[model samples]
Target: MRAGDTAPILAVPLLLLAALPAMGFADWLTLSASGLAMGMLLFLMASGLTLIFGLMDVLNFTHGAFVGFGAFIAASVWARLPGLVAAPGLAANLLALAAAGGAAALVCGGLGLAFERVVIRRVYGAHLRQILITVGAMIVAEQMSVVIWGPDALTLAKPASLASSFIVAGGAVEKFRLVAAALGLAAFAALRLVLARTRIGLVVRAGVEDREMVEALGYRVRRLFVFVFAVGTALAGLGGAMWAVYAGTVTAGLGGELTVLLFTVVVIGGLGSVSGSFLGALLVGLITNYVGFLAPKLALLANVALMAGVLLWRPRGLLPLVRT
Candidate 1:
């Protein structure tokens, strides 16, 4: 990695160190673990947006709608499969959860394809049009969800096996958080492998760097863009499913509320950069948690403050893509 590449990475430890002086060791440990888990979840959701922006250069304000819809879909799945989710066996609970996540991904992936074809295609290269149209689409999606789900907040219970906490170094860490962290790591590793080692990954990266060149090389760039959008939406769906369970409730506005945070993460991570998104997420998560604990009144301003600081230091974001 280049010297410039180390800035974002070192930021994580720096934030942690800064927090340590303000809290007790045990409190810090617990909060840090929770922060990391939250960050991982955010990364899972934001990574797709970054990829979509990086490769397709489309500002998909409707992305959060996918998340809100996915949460509802997964909630429905859990409601229908009570026997599986309520089973005492961990395997049964896990299987049921996996099924719900898969269902969300499949449904949202299909929706993303349709969204790209019908809504996004017309607004290509027009940032203002894209923003207005996609925001409108998001509002419509939220209303559609309210119509289908009755505008009531749906509750999602974690599996019995994952509802408790484990003690580590005298600090209590929630099992669900651990699961979330693990899943986030897996997603990151999988994305890295695919983007670094596979042919499709090569084409995607090439398209991101130079779309005209990739098209000139005989690859169908439009089709590839559609697929990337699908994948990005699928990831959003998956993250929404996980988040619904974490928050223990779902509402049509859930995605709308997250939209701000998601954009903050994408910008701080650097537009179109996954690794930057991951690091940016961690920083946001840590800062929020630390601030919430140290000064409850400023908790809400934590992310805004962090974003301002990062932008001041790196205007393009922590890990901006290099364009020739």
Candidate 2:
């Protein structure tokens, strides 16, 4: 990819940030920003899922559990160490919050790797069996989360300074959500760069296209699979942390239909396609935001309708290319 192509991706959030000041607070800017923010988080989570199932061909039914686990971790940190998160200075607070994110991602990565080795590895290529195993694992993980965190819903706390909401046109946009949106965009850019410019990315791309050949060439395909799995799970974990930070809450809804909608976004974007994921995300983001206002009763229905239209019209997804 050329630098010119990369420049536009880097420019989107900049453009959005610039537009923020011009819009009336009540004007749809807050909803647009929030929708994009949530959409970006979905992009992060779905990127990992698509890569695992689309490329490495691993069925990770427990991916949501990883996100839930990460959210719980961030929630715990904020609940325990409010001082560090609320500390003054952008650099310091960002660093501290990033540390918390790193911890959550790494923990989730370890769990994902272990699960792949002990459980998912056994069912490679067996979609039916993989589904069963993953579903079972999901059950176990859900039960564990509830047991540890209790049945009550827990809300994450933003630093006192960030919890403040600004009036935008008649709407309210939280300061912390703006930060989350910016960070989420950064994560999207970083993931794109990794896939486009790195050697591991090349191997991952190749593995997705032809794992048998990659392994026959004396490459450690299993290790590559494990790496991809870990990365995907970590992204989901990061999304969880970001969500906890943005929404200030954690609940078992992580494994139910809410989780299914996320997966649907992944599918609509096309499995294992990074650029496709972002594009699909923007579409879903816009649809969800606008439909909620026009037909509040069918907000979820709107997203589903959009996905169905894409699937029925293009079964393989809008973008179906595997760069090897």
Candidate 3:
């Protein structure tokens, strides 16, 4: 989609206004920021899946397991580095968080490589088999996590510096939420720059459109695919670490619970479009937060309703990529 497209962008303001009837300006601001933060975190978790699906046409049900794994890894790291996280200075706290996030990403990226080699390689190009095998893989991964971490939820406290909120005009805006939104924006920008300006990104995009042709051009498409998968998995892991801090707890089933929502964002955004994913995530986040506050009973159904409404309007999603 071109920059001129405004339909998706317009949805944000409309949704914000729709919530005005239920609360005052301060409440609205708080909810809006919260919703945007939630959306960004979702985008982080879902973006990689969208890329993998768009380029490799892989139905990776086990993607959620990576999220859970990343959260647990980061939590373990934090547990071991309590002093750094609870330090008085922001730099120390941030450093601890970065360390945990880096560790999670590295672990998940390596795991993704192994997953592609062992489980995913056998069923390439077969959607049904891909789904089945990946789902099975997810179940196995979840069970293994339980055995390793115990079947209980783990607490993940934000660094002391990030645990507080600041007043933004009269509304309290969380420090971590703002940080998450910034990180999400940074990730989006970096991804776009890589795709638009880098040689590897060019090869990846070309491969997405026509793998055979890219291979015919003498590029190592297979290695590129593996690299893309690893990157995607790492993104998911990083998102999970952020989410763990956001939620204050991490469980083995964290990824499973979010699978439906992640897929909804991906589908609404279009299979492979990063911008679409960001827009869709924002919509879902706003709808969820607003409805949850205004009409708690309908909160759970908000995303489903939003998805149906969007698909009914645009069957291919808001900004579906035109496959070459």
Candidate 4:
């Protein structure tokens, strides 16, 4: 669908007229920024899958658990940083937030590596078995997190300093929200640099191309597999941490069945490419954010329709880097 295919284009003029000149521009700009910010977060979460599928050829179903785990950890730490110290303000809160996110990444990464070593290794290249195991793992992880952290939803607050919202065109948005978006974009750029420029990334690319060959050439691909899994888990953790701040809650199972939605992004973006995931996520994010403006009932259609159209046109995905 082009510009003409959308009702938003038609509605924009009328909405502008209704709002007057200055109000319309401000409103549009703020909405667009929010959309972009949301898109960036999607990109962060989807990036993990891109690498996992790209390098390992594994369709992990339990990836979302890492995200939920991260969210829980972040929410708990952010909301309770004062308890950790006599006086917890902006600096302490930031440190706690970082610590929470970092700790979640570590914990998730460790679990990922262990899963890779203990169970995933046996499946090797078995996609079907991997699917079964991953689904089971997801259920177990979700339930275990609930048991450990309980079923209650918890709020994640930004520090009073950071939580403040700045007025943009008469509307206010949280500073933490903007920071989270910027962080996601920065992470993507860093990831691109790592994959394209570093030795670790070169090996990752090589491993993606031919795991057997990479192993046969004496480069322990098993270690690489672990690395990819850990990295994927870490990204999930970061996504969770950011989500906690954005959604203002740390409820269990936040990433529960959403693995399917993430997979949709991965497939539509391309199975094994970072750039593809980033592009797909941004598109999905924008659609999700702006679709409401196009008559609330037809809103969700934006994401679904965009995905369907992409898959229809590119069955292997938009940037099918790998034949899979």
Candidate 5:
């Protein structure tokens, strides 16, 4: 499938333009920023799956487990460092945020390594088994989280610097959301850069083309796969941590609840394409907010409708990396 089309790129601006007439300029501004922020968070969650799917070709149902793990882990970090998290100073707030995100990523990545070694390595080519086993693992992980964190939802407060919204052109944008968007954008850029301009990316792509040939070239494909899986899970965890901050609460089922949306993004963006996931996320986010505003009753079905429409128009998605 072609991956260079610019048509899909216009979806965001077009949607923004279409929504302008329905609300005031200020409202539109606020909603636009909100949608962009939402899209970024979704991107963070889905991007890892794209990488795993593209290179390793594994259907990892346990991806969501990492998200819940990250959120809970970050919550624990905040609880342990109450002073840094609650401080009004930016430096203190950043330190706390970094610690939480870093810890979540590390823990989730470690879990991914163990999971891949114990379970995933055995079911490399079996899609059905991958789905079933990973789903089972996800359930087990969720239950374990409940056992460790307790069954009650845990409240998470943003650092003082990010707890409030700032007004720009009469529109209010939460500081946390802005930071989340920036983080997501940076991740996207970095992933693109690494994949397109690095030797590791070259080897990965070469492996995707011919595993035996790459192995003949003395590259350890299996080790690379493990690394990719770990990175994917780590990204999911980081995304989950950011999401927890945004939602202000953490629950064991938080990740499971978002599974459908995450898959929708993966499918809509074209499985295995990071760029596609980014665009798909933005599309989902914008459509959701717009539909929520215009027809409150249809909010639940907005994503499905959008997915259906996109599929009808482009069966392979906007920028599929591989033929589906």
Candidate 6:
């Protein structure tokens, strides 16, 4: 990549430096930790969409449904295992979280398979129809959630072990946020490893570059599509589960509310680029936290401003994988 190409990566460090003078070092550290945690959550929510959007070429508005489902399902897990969730033991807390995340992934992954077969298969290459049908599906799914879980917002308290903060360099960093950041980094590294070093990754990348050619090579591209879609939704569900834990609440509309931010991350990071999405998410997370703290009123507009600015400076996003 050219230096010009890598310039966008500097935005995070520069943003960090820019904020130091505005607050005390400890305050800055706390906010930075918060921002990092939020960014990772955003990345978790948006990363799967990036894979589907870039690899599948399908416009799936129902992606939010998976997120909502993930959140509610995870909440249900915690509700059922109140003992484990509330236990002061770290092992019990970790078990509760693992179960919740696993359930979310499993349920959402199954839903993704059904979605790919019933809805997405028919609308291949048709953006408008894909948008309409998927959105309608999302609405239906949301209503189903209401029927099953009710319309009330559900709260997901962090497990006892992750509920407190520890002092780090005179700043208190929430243990949960630190865990989120670590998980996000692990997910990113895993994705990079799979996409760059494995045979399935090679095939997926090839499919992204030339689907017809892959099919012609007898690679069963259709199955590949289904696999991608399933995995994408699963990731989104996992992200949703984590987000519910982070935010302490999950509503029927949680996924819908996050859709805008997910798209912003996808767009700014480049439509199909995971690495680009990572950077875009960090920029957004930090920008929102800093601006929300510095200028409360602009919080709503902070992400949009960042998106617009990035687009004006690099219309193709930080690392656009596919040329339009």
Across residues 159-201, which tens digit of lDDT does each residue of candidate 6 receive? Answer: 9999999888888899989888888888888888899999998
Backbone clash count, each prediction separately: 0, 6, 0, 0, 0, 0
Candidate 3: C-alpha lDDT: 0.88
lDDT against the true structure, each candidate: 0.89, 0.75, 0.88, 0.74, 0.87, 0.87
Model 4 segments beyond 4 Å from truth?
A: 1-23, 83-93, 322-324
CA lDDT, candidate 2, residue 170: 75
What are the TM-scores, per candidate, against the unseen true structure? 0.97, 0.86, 0.96, 0.85, 0.95, 0.96
lDDT tens string, model 2, 1-324? 323344324433554454455545574677676778778877877788888886767667788888888888777766776677777655656765787688789888998889888998899889889889888888888889889988888886576667778886678787777777777688789877887789887777777778888888888988877888898888888888888777777886664534676677777777777776776676676567666765789988888887898788667665655545
Which one is best on lDDT? 1
> CA lDDT of 16 in candidate 1?
90
Which candidate gets the maximum TM-score versus the true structure? 1
> In model 4, which range of ten residues has the least summed lDDT?
1-10
**Which pairs of residues clash in candidate 4, taking residues 3 or more apart in a chain or in different chains?**
none
Tens digit per residue, CA lDDT, model 5, 102-137: 999999999989999999999998999999998999
Higher-scoring candidate on TM-score, 2 or 5: 5
Worst 10 residues of 1 by lDDT: 1-10
Q: Model 4: how far is 186 from its true place, Å?
A: 1.7
Q: Distance from true position, residue 323, model 3, in Å?
A: 1.3
Question: In candidate 2, where is summed lDDT lowest over 10 consecutive residues?
Answer: 2-11
**Runs with alpha carbons beyond 4 Å of true place in candidate 3:** none
Cα lDDT, model 3, residue 217: 92
**How many backbone clashes can be found in candidate 5?**
0
